[model samples]
Target chain A: MRDRLRNVLAGVLEVRPEEICADMSAEDVAGWDSLRQLEVMLALELEYGVRIPADAMLELQSVPAIEEFLTEHGAG
Target chain B: MSRLPTAEEIAGRRRQGLELTRVERPEATALHVLATFNLDLLPPFLTEAFDRVGRSVRPRAGAFGQLTQEILDPASRLYAEPPDEVLIVPAAEDLLEPLFSRPPSQLGPDEAEALVEERLAELRGLVETVLERLPAASCYVVALGATEGPHPHVLDPLAPERRQVELDRFMRGVRELRSLGPRTVVIDWDWHMRSFGWDAVRDERLWYLGRMRLNPTGCAALAELVARHAAAYRGQARKVLALDLDGTVWGGIVGEAGLGGIEVGEDGVGLAFQDFQRELVKLQETGVLLVVCSKNNPADALEVFERHAGMVLRREHLAAERINWQDKATNLRDLAVELNLGLDSFVFLDDNPIERTWISQACPEVLVPELPDDAAERPAFLRAASWFERIEATAADRGRSASYREQRERRQFERTSTSFEDFLSSLEQEAIIDPVHEGSLSRAAQLCQRTNQFNLTTRRHTVAELESMSSDPDHDLFTLTVRDRFGDNGITGIAILRYAGELAEIETLLMSCRILGRKLEDAFLAFLARRAADRGASVLEGTFVRTAKNAQVETFYPDHGFERAEDGVYRLTLTQGAVESPASIMVTVPANA
Candidate 1:
């Protein structure tokens, strides 16, 4: 599950999965801007078959937050 | 037509497209995008869509909600360094904020009507400004969609007071802007939304997060539409739709099942085939020449068009037919020759995977779309294919199939004649040469793009470029219209000549392949040489740039009393009088020319 989440994040951010650390957020990545953050949320919904609420879309900017949210929604 | 790409796939393509744009490809087309909302997510998808069609594009979006500023200001990024193409997307929610922010019940009928009119006028002004500022760019304006506004009653008829009705009025007004100019094309965003489903296209999460109205799926769909339009603008639109007979057009094999046993009536799967045939007929009406390339007995196939009660397509509907036992690729090539079109303009449809694969390998230029597995999905599949899209159909386009039938009659006349010169004289061909006018601009530009075999320098100039060239003093643009004993072939030839102090250079000279062997090219060139000499020129020069398809005309200049000079250039001195036109053709020139 961790590997899959990293792959999804890396795909949207246009980075290597090996470079995607759990602590990395939008600011830490080179191409991860606010527009890419929306793409990240949308990709998570499609990859995990889970719906992240609108308010939580902005909060899940870091890789760790996305994994935690996915686990809480039973997608893990 | 297969399946909409998933979010993960779209993400991967977007990344790939971004990486592709970072490289310096000199052949890439530049595209500028302007929208009413945050359209930052569109460039990558648009780049991928254009890439899928074998075209690379560099897309840059303007600041959000700056459509008006970009159009009005001459120093804006859109006008500073103009792009090859422009895409303008306007949403009803952003354009009509006052009406949407309030309830439909609160707004009066007169107030809503006035507001809608004012907004549409503003949009028209912006589009006109863009068209004037970027005369050489192909602009695509997306019509307003009913993405916002309160839901009305299920069975309520549209009224001016209703917000939904007002939005519909706005969309229709936008569609009429297609008449503003030849280069302006209005995309029906409402139709795309209804076809793709409203729920699947819009994402509330993205809207709240970054004010983006469309999700990745919607973005991909829009990108596909714009890319198809761009390809059509570049003259990549297909002209011929070639189909196979048996299990492809109808159900079952005609050789084994016979006419009575074939499934093509108004019942179950049979109805599907009938509907599919109807779609093909629609395509035929739109000037796409339909031809049969089936591997069956000619008599057997002819009987289906003559006697089948369920057949929607008749023998007259087909511009040409190749019902032989030959290979599919060979049949398509023969059809291209018979129709006087390049193989790149042919789109082949066949249900058999083996035949499709064969044609794909043999003739790489032919577009062979994969038909759906289910028979019922065939009609929808044809509707979704964008290879036959055109921005606007000219008069010549609408009369193409009928003109091809006339060409068939001319071929029969040629067979019975004793000699080539005798055939040319008996045809009584009359060539009318004139400067490019308003009515003939589209067809002239089309000939410049689509004419490959007989063209000397294959330069594909757009209508806007041709218009500007026609107004220039030192350049002369001429179109040749041919009328033989059989029929009027419309404007089938074009020539562009550049004049200097003492030299007249033939910049472009091309004729439609239908009029190739008729000595029309000789008459056209003779007329141009005389015109150049009359304009106080001492020498006439032409260059023959070799292409794969134009090898037959490598020595055309030399055959017409021209001496070969250095660098593949042919020179003829006007002091000795221009080369005389063939006596077989009666040529007429405009008084001004």
Candidate 2:
């Protein structure tokens, strides 16, 4: 689950895999704009094989929020 | 009839005209323009932009305000904008369905629902108005229906099903306008306006839209559609999507990344690249050639295709490839040459800016789409690009993906062998050529429009032309469907045989270039010769008129069993029997005309 989150974060930020961290939040990443936020949500859904409802995707702000939601939705 | 004039032809026409403004050209002798929209529905600026084109007018706007019990006769307005007097007539909206049956003050939620019903009713009226006001030989454009707001009101009625009822209703209105005749060309207004933004349409090219409104891309598409409709309406171009390895196909340069380092696995940015490649592979179902061109060594690229289980695009999927460090422009030229295609027929993609710019400067005819600066944008960018635009693909088109795959196998076979004739003979290539009947008319017409390289005379026809000809009782249409030892090449070639007095003339002879190397042309002419013999005709005639792209088959007549006649024409005598229907081939009856 951590690995998949890292991949989505890398794709959204257009950064190397090494640049991503587990503690990252929207403010922590330089590339996390509103457009990139939508992109990350889409990528996360595709990666984890889960349909994160539009509302849940909006509520997800930090890496921990995404991880907990993925657990709840059977993504992980 | 030949297929529509391409973008190049439109540009050529623009050059011939006296440039009144960058937008309007009046010098060309046959200058006519028509606009079809409720003028009141359009923002005023769009109408002004359209004024740049010669003699633009709309009937709906002038008549719209007066569509009440109070006003019986609608007014007309004229504007002198681009030195040409534009006559605008206000047609009575007897057809205009009222948006609100009751006063606006009396409207409730239910009233709003009723208002939508009334609007749809108005659309039917608009369709009737379109039929009455459509001008002769003038271009017509229609705006897509506007959604009332960001909310999904119209779609909600159809709901969960995504039934597209409102869309279909709008299309029905457009169809009624089209059924009126030649001058009506309906634009995909809804799709265009949403995608390109509305303001962009108003500011862009306007002449193509008739009097309707569209976004810039929609407007350009409208102009292209008009030009195509006016010239020859061929189905859309079947694309050969040539991809690049290293930087282009993946996130990083493959040559530098090595096999394991390359981005194409379950993790990292590779997943995005993998997803993109997989989508491209799916496009082969629609007959797009997935060819590979990269500066990496062929062996290294082959390693990715073979050993890498994670690789989405396999080696067999590519029809042709150029992996040498040769200039990509030159490599693309070689690929086209080997395949007997014009550079314009290709759409090249590479991630490296230097290589892309080189192709742009050198092979300017090829469409090199601008990739987004970021890696994540690759998928969305390609989805938006017009790389795949076929209107519809037949069974043959579906087989194209496999045919190209076999071509790669055939090329590998060629490398280890010596004699070209021996390779040709070993494949057991068989062609089934038959007279085009009502069942095969649509595919035959599509072939004439799409096939360029091996076409003897590039004549294009529409659905109407074939229908008219079938009814005429004077013409013969012949289609060829080939299946070799490898697989079925479904309707790869078509020839329209027209009976002129006692002579049979070949109006159009075209074959998909995928089956070019096989001796199918010989079999085709021989079959025609036998048909001529059976008919008691002495002379079988054909012509090899040259086009910019069809130079490959310029000597096609003389090379086969035909003699040169006066001025690029060819003739053959089939009084004697010709080659028997090649034993291995089977000609099946086409399912639909």
Candidate 3:
């Protein structure tokens, strides 16, 4: 699961997957924004073929939150 | 896939792409657009069209002896700096003489024919020159000439038979040259005729002088013609034709005409209705979708189309038909909903002054041709409309009319279904999406530039600008080409993903007008959401910059689940699990899009 998240973040954030971590937050990341957040969502869903509910979008606050949500939602 | 080609190669594929996106950039690349003119009968507005497209024109002196020499000799000294996108618009003062009773003898049969041949040869040479310089620059040749009029003196030497001979020969020459490799487009003016016989050229001075006397119908025709060619060359026609019935399709009202009294048949005023129907039917054949908004009993109108012998357009022909006795504005709104067409694609034609005025006031996006009060003038009136000016029509257009008809029938079947979701499920719409690659890049950039409504952050990019984005390591341009069970909608939507360090931004999001309302956009956003979440990116940011035509998408993010952030921005967090594309929407993202 951690490796999968890193691969997705690697492409979206234009960083090596090794550079991404579960502790990453908007303030900690240099380029994170609402726009990039959507890109991350799309890439992850496309990569995993998972369905993201519209209501759950509001609950996503940080990488840890995304990790927990993805695990719960069966997104790899 | 191999690394994307350099920006220069993408711009090299098509020149206009670069021009559109690089307009404000300080560094200007030179483009050579061949604008040929008769120099003998040029219109004052020809230059304006060229100017509108941002081309610097150098008028080549046509084959008029000293005039040609005069333009060529001092030309270098007259303006030292050669302009970018030099155009050669072939216009002449000769065409105007026919408008006047006094005809110029200089354009004798032999001279005119010889000049025609000479110009044909020149055009061929220009094509060769432009092709040789291709990759570095591109040129477009616009062919426009005068038509025969009523003035007999002018008509005497420039007889229709003789002019037809020259025109045929010139056209032959054009075909031969086109075979050799020129990207050529012809604007035929031979069809423009005065009401009177061919000798009407003799009456040019007495009747219509100074003005082209181009009526609404004629303007629409010319615009439609130009638009067709523009689409063919530029790659697609983004405009949609929205229509109205009742007084428009028939004389009197459908509510009042009582089906049989509509007056569309073999006799007197019936001929007017007949002619109008025939012309519109022909337009439908050219790939223009016919949509109807009528205030009538839906069953009665359907019966007319299904039962009437004189009815040329059946109910099956329309992309969308709104037949409720409600305000036309309301019907127009419903029609947009039914077809997923934007208001801008709609060109409404209504004969009734009141209804026409109402629609014009209520839905300003629709182009309503003002018909003359005399029903007798309807034929001439339609001849002058600009709704049909198109630069080119591909094979796809030929099937458009038929496809829309089939689409309507399918919708009707769905109407009886239990729920909208059930209807969507039954139709089997699917969307196939792929990363933006070389094959689809040209078309994708066009959607970004032309699509006006339903656009968020209406960022118009040129092929050049898009190419630059692809080259710059921080930016990613992804295009979505959509097709469904109905027909191929071509490359309809574009998403520009720009990144700064770890964060990504949607710099541009736009969809073609025809593909709206099907939840393809929701699917697109969902795709974006999932992609964003994967990158460990917490929030996906976007903006809705307003334009007069793009209010339809002002609250697009909110409806699609994004929350409004500070200033005009919207944000969505990726932890939002499993975003599903709108419920049971039938969209097919092309597997190879």
**Which candidate number has the best lDDT?**
1
Q: Sort by TM-score, best first.
A: 1, 2, 3
> Which pairs of residues have clashing backbones in candidate 1?
none
Please identify model 2 stretches exceeding 4 Å from their true place. A1-76, B1-96, B99-143, B149-186, B196-238, B265-271, B306-311, B408-430, B434-442, B460-467, B532-537, B547-568, B578-593
TM-score per model over all chains: 0.94, 0.62, 0.55
Question: What Cα-based lDDT does every candidate model obtain?
Answer: 0.85, 0.58, 0.57
Candidate 2 per-residue lDDT over residues B1-593, each given as its tens digit: 11223434332332222122224434332322323332322322223223333223222233323333112222323111121111211221112222213332454444445444565455445434433332222224443454332234446654422223433554455445544333234545445446545454442222222233442233344444333333323455536777888766676755787888777876767787877787777776677777788888888888888888678877766778888988888888888876656677688887778778888899897888876666667766766554465434567668776776676677788676578767676667766665665456557777776777888888866544654555555566677877766667777787777776678788778888877766777777777776655555677889987887788888877776678866667888766554444443443433332
lDDT of 2 at B147: 32
Q: Quantify how close model 1 is to the true structure by its C-alpha RMSD in Å.
A: 2.4
- The deviation in Å at residue B241 for candidate 1 is 2.4
In order, what is each prediction's RMSD in angstroms?
2.4, 17.6, 25.9
Error of 3 at B388 (Å): 3.1
Candidates 1 and 3 compared: the better one by DockQ is 1
Candidate 3 runs further than 4 Å off: A1-76, B1-44, B47-86, B90-140, B144-170, B173-184, B189-247, B252-259, B341-344, B394-430, B433-446, B461-479, B483-490, B495-507, B513-544, B548-593
Expressed as tens digits, the lDDT of each residue in B1-593 for candidate 3 is 01122323322222333233335634533322222222221221223223333332332223332323322443532123333222333432232232223323646556656766777776666555544433222234433344433343444554643355555566556545535422344544333332322342222321122122232223223333333343344433434565566666767665676777787777788777778787777777776778787777888778778876777666655776777878889888887766666676677877678888898899997777787777677776765654564444434456666655655666677679898677666656666566666555556655675677878887766443565466566666676665565666555678877666556578888886656666788888887776666544667888899997889998888876778866868877666654577766543443432
